[model samples]
Target: MSKILNEFLSSNLQELKDNGLYNEINVVRGANGPVIDIDGKELINLSSNNYLGLATDETLKQAAKDTIDSHGVGAGAVRTINGTLDVHVELEETLAEFKGTEAAVAFQSGFNCNMAAIQAVMNKEDAILSDELNHASIIDGCRLSRAKIIRVNHSDMDDLRQKAKEATESGQYKKVMYITDGVFSMDGDVAKLPEIVEIAKEFDLITYVDDAHGSGVMGKGAGTVKHFGLEKEVDIQMGTLSKAIGVVGGYIAGTKELADYLKVAARPFLFSTSLTPGDTKAINEAVKMLMASTELHDQLWENGDYLKKGLKSLGFNIGNSETPITPCIIGDEKTTQAFSKRLMEEGVYAKSIVFPTVPRGTGRVRNMPTAAHTKEMLDEALEIYEKVGKELNVIS
Candidate 1:
């Protein structure tokens, strides 16, 4: 053991603990459904990103079992060296169709998806204009690319346009790409992609939208780009199979040239083993299900509206969420965490998000109402929220 390493970790961890920022992960005993069992207590789960309740769906479970029985668990080798299976190809094709893209490439995770796609195309000579509030994965990906990064104000079109114009006119880079999240995870606000595309057109810039939270919840399960009918306009559309699709993996949907380029050039694809057969098959089945029906999508929106209305009527500040994600702003970090703790004790399991995940003094308990949540479950959670809110002086 290294003494320096030990001291560094200990000091940082102590700082986190002293600042009310230490995260203690809970153990979910079984499937991550609407109701989850944690340490012998079943709680109405509002923390999961299982937007459409497909994580523990019986059909997806069967699909996974069948694929595992047929193809084993691992991909056996890196994709560049025969790891690519038939199901992987099928998944890529299905994802392309689902995303309305000409071709697609699958990755091990959403984080890697951004890393691979960004670095694969953009390099040290390029400049990336990224949304300030984009996901951590995108931030890390841009860093990995070694590009001249410019941070645009969150959802500010004029800022993006001005910066883009400067970057394009300065003649300092070979390419300029604007990257943003289709729907921000923490705040639940939808990105203004149409304005982004307009800016791209004005400057001939590349466009990338990481629609991790929007895949199954927006555009009738197609995505944000499709919702705006910009399938041909946006250059790259990245999505995850874990969140709403309720499996695990990520993919980039775009033209065949881009897909082919990534297939050969992306480091993760060239160096890392591909997604497992079971996960691939499960993702394929989930995408098919999403394309086949809008039942779950509609139900998800209904639950969101119901929960938002309930929170608002109780005088809680739920932010401007265009999707099903709801955040009850609690302001102070300790109070926000205490509110979440009380909710858990009262049989609800929403998590408190504070800095540096969000801005300081804007701590919140983020609620994610899935399609699997019953009306009774939401009602019960709301009742507990009311009681806790009044007790904590968060509501009158």
Candidate 2:
């Protein structure tokens, strides 16, 4: 490395470590499930995004194995090249059917889905009204679009309406788009889509919903757009197969025209290699399973409610989460990190999320209680949380 690079890294590293902002990522020894082994200790895991527990499901595993035996591993090249396999088409078809869209296009990851979709449609000549608490990927994608970005206060329809009116009336741009997450990942609050749809209609703004966290957690596992029954109104619906679907990849479900445009225009889809045949097959299987039954989704909600009630009863500041994602807010960064550490040591592996991931002085231990978590496991995790909370003086 260059000397200048070395000095820059050393100073930033020291500052983060000194202020308790540095994160130490633990290694999971095996399959990520309700229980995980880290550092030779088994802990009740509350950190994974595998909301439906399909990551280790026998059906999904068998689908992957069967595909690998026949199709081998990789997709050979980019989708724009010769990489479009039959399984790829099938997966996209499944996604569209699941999301109640006319067509869909898949990407390498959830992050790339935002990167690809936003830039493919919007340009610098346009303006974007974005939610203040939107995910980092959506923020970066908006930046990449070169659009004039307006930050709308989190879930404030009034702020969005004013921004939309200003952008559209100013005539400073050709198109004004509104982008938001279907579910705010950090806070677990669902988006106000009905009001958003009405405002978008009034302003003629192109609407985009990044439903990465909402994909399998909302709409009976279809997604947030479906949950609100706005399947025909939202312009673009983006989601991930990685989370509740418990596989790997992202997709944009929309009209046939949008899918066709993205297939030719999106840089990630044109340049990056396609998803593996096995992963595509497995994702298709998972989506089909969800569409067939809501057993897993129901269990996920039941567990979320259980954990939220348990934490709140102990005097922990579990924020106003509307989903299975429960956040135990600890104001100071150092204390939040220590609380998570104590929980891990006590055999519950919930991680601390701090600044740049969340705002300063609002550090939290985010718990994702999946369908895989048994009542027994949740009770044990709650017991551990109570012990750690009192020991740290986080609860009375």
Candidate 3:
């Protein structure tokens, strides 16, 4: 490697370490579940996004195995080419039905979906009104679109309405779009979708919602759009198969015309390889499970409530979360990370979120409670949390 590049890497990494922003990745010995083993120690895991716990479900595992046996390991080509298999078509169909949309299209990952979807629909002449706290993928997507992006305050309906009205009335752009997260990941808050849709209608702006964290967790697992009964009204709905779906991919659900347009216009779908057969099969089965019953969904919320109540009872600031995602706010970055480290030492695996991932000085330890966690497991985790919180002076 060049000397200049080596020096650049070393300096940047050192800077991260000095600022307490460096992440030390823990290796999981096996499948990610409610309980995970790390470096010879088994811990109660509360850091995963496996809300419904289908990641290691027997049915999904079998579906993946069967697909691999029949279709081999790879998709063979990009989606625009021969990579589009019957299983892929079936998955899209299932997604469309599950989302209550006219059609849908899948991508290699949620990030790719955002990149492709935004650029496909918007260009230099368009304007995008995006939520300030939307996912990094959405921010990157807006940047990639080359459209003028106006950031609206997080979940501030008045800000969104004002921005939407201004963007539309200015008449400087061919089209205006408002994009937001259906569920804010860090804070565990649901987006104001109903109000957003109403504003979009009043301003005649295109509406998009990234429901990555909402799918399989809200509206009996149909997601936040359906939770607010705006499935048919929102112009574009994007979701991930990786999170609650317990598989790995992302998709855009919309009208048949939008799907058709994206098929030809989305560069990532045209250029990158499609999802593997096993993943597609597992995703399809996961969606089927969500459509079949609400048992897992209910359990996930129960676990979330249990953990949240336990943390709050201990005097930890859990924040205002409306979903299963819980955050134990610690305020200071180093203290927050130290709190997480102490929890791991006490046999609970949770991670700390700080500056960049969240606003500075508002550090938090985010906990994800899944359906797979047993009552016994949660009880043990809570006990560890209590001990660690008290020891760290995060709780009395």
Candidate 4:
């Protein structure tokens, strides 16, 4: 109610509007899948993270319904108190097995998991070498740890080695950790885990990989750490169930000792209520499905290849992507936003990612093709892209 606070907020919001950075959120009127309904328009959804398209799977839905009937809707207390239900423990066990880790712990969301896990392990006395293009969650986690953060150039082994050697040689901290995203969401590029593992060993640095986008996409659906066979090498592996698993939670998979330590020390784990029984059960089923079958994973790759090739054929700049995530590089923020708006208007829904989310001038419209999208649907989407691309003069 303070006039000063109102004025400050208004000024900041106005700045966003003036700069074409203020985004109006669209309401998804139907279920989220490879296609969705936004503002009464049916659009081929290429911006969702449901990589395996398990979010709307009948099996997962049934599992959630059954669990809700049996366990009710919520875990009524914080995990440390009484919220840790059997389903939660089961999911943790399943996740540990899936990730090839000794143990695992779940949190309310991937963002909170990053905040809790990073802060729990790295204190002010510790130093962290972070990848320059790591996720915002990783950046926030590093900040929360209060560590001496040294950002190595993205995917540059030389830079990482130099920083690691310098930090370790200086001996200014109790522990040194290196953190990166296993698969960058924007570019869909896999992290150089082999190089990172070697550096971590040489410097005796703790390794942390946030595989939010890599889970159920890389390593035949296990993750990037598993893709590179670094499960035993990396110290901490974090992932989100909300994306590929079609549920709402996050987890950190690591050694039993590390998981135990997080259970006691991580603020989000200790203070936040545990995931609902329905979510926990659905996630368990989703993990089981991923481990048991590769159908969805294959379909996801097919869709990704189809979409990427189609975009390329239309003369749109699809960046170097090795995973399901595809980016149509637009360079400028305003142009990127305009491009996205035009796509939506043309009945395709892909979001524009700009400054802060990504580096300035590297603005792009990121597309996430899931297993649920049919070939015909992708063809239709590509046609729309061609139409919009020409209209925007992005392509001939």
User: Highest TM-score among the candidates is held by which one?
Assistant: 2
TM-score of 1: 0.99
Candidate 1 C-alpha lDDT tens digits along 1-396: 799999999999999877777777999999999999999999999999999999988898898899999999999999989899999999999999999999999999999999999999999999999999999999999999999999999999999999999999999999999999999998899999888899899999999999999999999999999999999999999999999999998999999999999999899989998999998999999999998999999999999999999999999999899889999999998899899999999999999999999998999999999999999999999999999999999999
Model 2 C-alpha RMSD to native: 0.6
Deviation in Å, model 2, residue 138 alpha carbon: 0.5
The TM-score values for the models, in the order shown, are: 0.99, 0.99, 0.99, 0.99
Q: What is candidate 2's lDDT per residue for 1-396, written digit by digit as tens?
A: 999999999999999988889999899999999999998999999999999999999999999999999998999999988999999999999999999999999999999999999999999999999999999999999999999999999999999999999999998999999999999889899999999999999999999999999998899999999999999999999999899999999999999999999999999999999999999999999999999999999999999999999999999998999999999999899999999999999999999999989999999999999999999999999999999999999998
Candidate lDDT (C-alpha), each:
0.94, 0.95, 0.93, 0.92
Angstrom error of the Cα, residue 147, model 2: value is: 0.6
What's the CA error at residue 259 for candidate 4, in Å? 0.9
Give per-residue lDDT, candidate 2, residue 78: 99
Q: What's the C-alpha lDDT at position 130 in model 4?
A: 92
Quote the positional error of residue 150 for candidate 3 in Å: 0.2
List ranges where model 2 is wrong by over 4 Å: none
Q: Quick one: best lDDT, which candidate?
A: 2
Runs of candidate 4 with Cα error greater than 4 angstroms are none
For every candidate, C-alpha RMSD to the true structure in Å? 0.8, 0.6, 0.8, 0.9
Q: How well does candidate 2 score on lDDT at residue 197?
A: 100
